[model samples]
Target: MISIGHSPDADDLFMYYAIVFGWVGDDLEEKFENQALDIETLNIATIQGIYDVSAISFGAYPFVRENFALLQTGVSFGDGYGPKLIRKKTTQLKKNFRVALSGVHTTNAIIFRLAYPEARIVYKNFLEIESAVISGEVDAGVLIHESILNFDTSLEVEREIWDIWCEKAQEELPLPLGGMALRRSIPLNKAINIESTLTKAVEVAVKNKKILSKMLIERGVIRVDEKELDIYLDLYANKDSISLNDLQKKGINKLFELGFKAGIYDVLLECEDYFIPTGYQALRNS
Candidate 1:
């Protein structure tokens, strides 16, 4: 059995559940066992080489480049919106304000730190960030996943992380959030097969999004209700997520460059160079 680790967020569930439901890859000999954890936990697990395949924050990918190569499918991007930095209404943030972030290794945290170098940061689970801000546990907190959509009225948006991404990007590009990566130790042929299967799984999921969404709601598999889940899926789990198009690949490269320039990475790596070479499968068969 191949182990898979992903966030329990609606987007991750939307992309991965087709495999669980046996709607795709039924002909393959491999069996997939999935574990749902918070994105931060999955990021740490990916760096440790714990799962054969995992969903990881793009910011965390540079550290694990040697052991894991990115998969083309199952990526999340923010076009014009993303994680929100929120604080209690009528409160003004100081330069050294204490803030709660989802995790130290998350993409939002990494970018948030770069944007607010003087801010004091504490790590908390994504679920706790909103409450932390409300209770004065911190001056502000970054809300991710579904929290970005339906935050409490008492809290107000301080800034959007996507704005920071745009300023740093210096060009039009989607904000690269998270993606799937496969362990490089897997044999090339088997790796190719697995990537193909997973790619199809994502495509199938997008094609049958309505059907799958209903199934998830009926089974109580996702945290959000149908309306919230539908909106979240469109933002993060749509057709663009099925594979890395040229633009998305460029976006990932830009993220790596940004991380490298900020001293978060030792080297600047091209994102496409690290993907599993599926073309090799055809060559070997021929």
Candidate 2:
């Protein structure tokens, strides 16, 4: 059995249910067990080499590079929008403003740190961030996942993480948020088969989006209402998420570069160099 870890958000639910529903990879002999958790928990778990496959922040990849190979499919990117920094009142932030971030290792936290280096930081679950801000536990908070869409009226926009990412990037690229990673400890042939199965799962999910979304709603698996879930899937789990294209690859590399320059990671990583070597399977079959 292969264990998989993914977030409980709508986008992840949308991408992963194709596999859960047995819509893909029927020929594969491996059985998958899925675990739904918050992204921060999964990130920390990936660092420990806990799951055979997992969804992780792109920002967390460098730290887990030794044990995990980034998967080509099931990626989330922001074209011109992403995590939001919200405040209870519209006021100028002090140099040492207290901020609640989803996690220390999240992509939003990495970008937010670069943008506001002097801010005091605290870690909170994405679900608790809005309440943290409303209750004034922190002066501001960076909202990730679905929280980006449905914030309370009492809260106001402080900034967008995408704006910070754009400011720091060398060229315009989609903001890399999260993607799946496979444990490198798995045998190469099995890893290739698993990757192929997952790639097909993403494709099938996108093709059957409406049917799948209805099923998810009926099952009460998602947090948002049907309309909100539809919008969330369009933003994070569309066809572009099926695999890494050239542009998405560049975007991920740029994010790694940014992290390296900021001293968040010791070495710069080329996104493609770390992927599972599926071509070996082709060579073997040839």
Candidate 3:
């Protein structure tokens, strides 16, 4: 049996549904068991090597790279958008202003830190971030995931993490947000099979997006209504999600490199070196 861990959020639910709905290889389907948790919880479990395969933040990769290899499929990238920093319309942040971040391991937090090192950060659940900002408990907060979709009118966007990313990246590369990680201790052959299964699952989901999205809403796996769900999925689970492209690999590497330089990681890593060897199948066929 293989255990798969992922977030319960809409994009994750959308991407993994093909496997959950039995659209992949039958044998692989029977062996699969999935666990749904919030992203921060999954990131912690992934670092502990608690699941055979788990979803993780790109920001968390540097810490877990020693034990897990990232899966090339089921990724979320933002081309011109991402997490948003929000504050009351009249609020003006001074240096060292307190900002609420979803989690220290979240991609948004990493970008926020790089952009505003002078700010003081406090961690909170993503669900509670908006309320904290509105309650006057924080000067600003970074809104992530579905929180970015709908927020209180009293709060205005201070800045988008996408803009922060663009300034930091200094080129046209999508921001690498989150993706799957598989335990390296799994024998190499088994790791390759799991990787291929996940890649196929993402492909199936993208091809049957309408049916899957409908099922997701009916099942209450998605929090947003149909219209918002459509928009949210397009943002995070669109074509870029089915597989990682060269540009995304570069983005992921840049994320790790910057994090390492900033002391977020003990060592620098190249993302390509950590992927499962799907090339083995082509070699066998040749």
Candidate 4:
């Protein structure tokens, strides 16, 4: 049995897996009997599974590299809709602003620091970020995940950090959204099989819009409109092809450089080991 962990944002992959793996039927029993896949929410604590894939962020990369082995690469989701630096319209920002993040050690926080070195960042769960921004607890908020879609309109978008990275790099950098990975102990064939299955699953999901939409709603993780989600899934999913050369590596490298410039990562070489290039030159060139 293989155990895969990923963030809530990666629910699309899970939905695709269910569709392609024959794991969903009129009832749950038939689904489970037909498919031998298991999935769970990824966290820092669950890094030791025999076969593990994670939606690694900046903070998680250090942990994954220190613990797991590199495996096949996956598609890039592109720089996320750009993390929103939101502030209450009434708030004054004469001084360096205070910001709230999902976690201080998360990729969002690192990107925030790289984009605004002088700002103060604090940790809060997703629920608290918008409230903090609106109630004056924080002058600005760095929002990710579904929070990007659910953000209150009253708050103003001061800047998009990923846009800054794009400007600096002069290319559309992949935001290192997430990928499939395996534990060092897994048999190489098993890992390859899992990758192949997942890639095909994604393709199936893309073709079956009804199943994909139902999966998203059932999961309750996506707050965006169905049209938007459809567009996103179509753009990001191409299961027949797997490439690591896109924005994921380049965007990550850019982020690493920014992290070094901002003094967020103490050892740059350590960060370098976290990126494993998958051999798809088209993705690299794109």
Candidate 5:
């Protein structure tokens, strides 16, 4: 059995549930089981090599490349928008202002650090960030996940992480936020097969979007209700999330370059070097 792990957020669930629901078909040589955790927890578990496959932050990928290889499918990227930095009304932020981050290793946090190197940072669960800011626990907090949509009215967006990405990325690349990773020790054939299966799962989910959304809501598999979940899924689990394209690959490489330059990584590495090999299937078919 292969253990797959992903965040409990609606986007992650939406991308993976077709396989969970048996809609991907039962023609697998390996059995699959899934577990859900918060993104931070999943990233930490990735350090331990806990799952055969797991959803990991792009920021954390640089550190774990030896243990996990990037999977092209099941990714989340942002075009014109992404996580928001917010604070209670009229609270001006200074360069040295303290901020609450989802986690030190999240993609948003990575950009936030590079953008505001002097800002004092404290890590908190994504859910508690708004209250922490409102209670004056910190000068600001970076809101991620579904919180970017319909946040507390009292708070205001200071700026978006996407804006930072645009300034840093000269290329017209979307910001790579999260994607699935496979354990490097797995056989190349099995790893490639799993990646293909996941790509199909995402395609099926997007093709049958309404039905899956209703089922997810009815089964309480996601946090948001119908309308909000619909918006969230469209933002993160759309056609682009089905597989990595050339731009998506460049986006990830950009992230690695930035992280390495900022001293977050010990070495720079290419994203393509770690992806599961796909040429084997073509070779056999030929």
Candidate 6:
């Protein structure tokens, strides 16, 4: 009886769960019977113990640390989905500049600081940031989530913060887009099994080509272009990259470096047995 929570951007993986977890036909009603609300709402509701597993943004790390006991691991959309430093198509950042973000404590804010340490960062909602950038409220804005896909290219991409991280780290670092995490109350063995199951499901979905295409079409999150969907899935559904060990050590280290450089966090919070040893080895071998 796992109560899973995620954002709308994760609908494709949710649909895969609907198929693999026997929730698609008459079982759909039973599977999500206890779902409190949408992913964002449910994550907020985590303070009330409404869910055991959650998919949360990296920007929510500070909140999660203060509010919950959980382990962060699993599949993510990768670094490409990180915040983009954008300016007007004609504008450029010569020296220091003012940057608008979705929120002060949001993930984009953290990424913006890491990428442009010299810039002045301001907070704004997603819609407001778009308007602000266009209206010249700020010199540039950091965009995230669906905004990356839906953004009007009239705004030029100054730099992708994740791309910068990749260049600096010299590895294809997972940008903690979001992934499944379990509360401390859940048994450790059960959490391991669930993680293994999800890893396998993603692999199967990736291989099945047809299922991946159908999922994108059914969700309407993206247009009905197989090539586009393929690219998205390939970027997000990285089978070998989803493991507790990599996320805890490699992934967390990279994020910590970014956070420290950006001044969003002081240091990475340590966790015990954060990675499953066998799973880590398998990912390495693959």
Best-performing candidate as measured by lDDT: 2
Candidate 1: list runs displaced more than 4 Å: none
For each of the candidates, the C-alpha root-mean-square deviation to the true structure, in angstroms, is 0.9, 0.9, 1.4, 6.5, 1.1, 5.7
- From the highest lDDT down, the ranking of the candidates is 2, 1, 5, 3, 6, 4
**What are the Cα lDDT values of the candidates?**
0.91, 0.92, 0.88, 0.56, 0.90, 0.57
Q: Which tens-of-lDDT digit does each residue in 15-58 have in candidate 2? A: 98998988986888888999999999999999999999999999
TM-score of each: 0.98, 0.98, 0.96, 0.73, 0.97, 0.70
* Candidate 5 C-alpha lDDT tens digits along 201-253: 99999999999999998898788878899889889999999989998899999
Clashes of each: 0, 0, 0, 1, 0, 0
lDDT of 3 by residue, 1-286 (tens): 8888999888888888887777885765338788998788888998889999998999998788889988998999888999899999999999899999988898889989998999999999788889999999999999888889999999999898999998888876889998999998988777888888888888888888899999988988788999998899899998889889999999999898888888888888999888888787778779
lDDT of 4 at 93: 67
Worst 10 residues of 1 by lDDT: 23-32
Tens digits of per-residue lDDT for model 1, 3-109: 99989999998899998999887877778999999999999999889999999998899888999998999989999989999999978999999999998888899
Whole-structure CA lDDT of model 4:
0.56
Q: For candidate 5, list the clashing residue pairs, or say none.
A: none
The parts of candidate 3 lying over 4 Å away from their true place are 284-286
Give per-residue CA lDDT, model 4, range 1-286, as digits (tens).
3455544453345334553346433222212112222222243433544335554454445445656644334443444464677888777665468888776555656666666778777878756789998888888887665566556878988877667657655677666544455565545444445555655555556566566666666766565667666655554454422545544655666766666666766656333354333333336458
Candidate 4 backbone collisions, by pair: 174-247
Question: Where does candidate 2 have its weakest 10-residue lDDT segment?
Answer: 86-95
Q: How many clashing pairs in candidate 5?
A: 0
Q: lDDT, candidate 5, residue 202?
A: 95
Using lDDT as the yardstick, the better of models 5 and 6 is 5
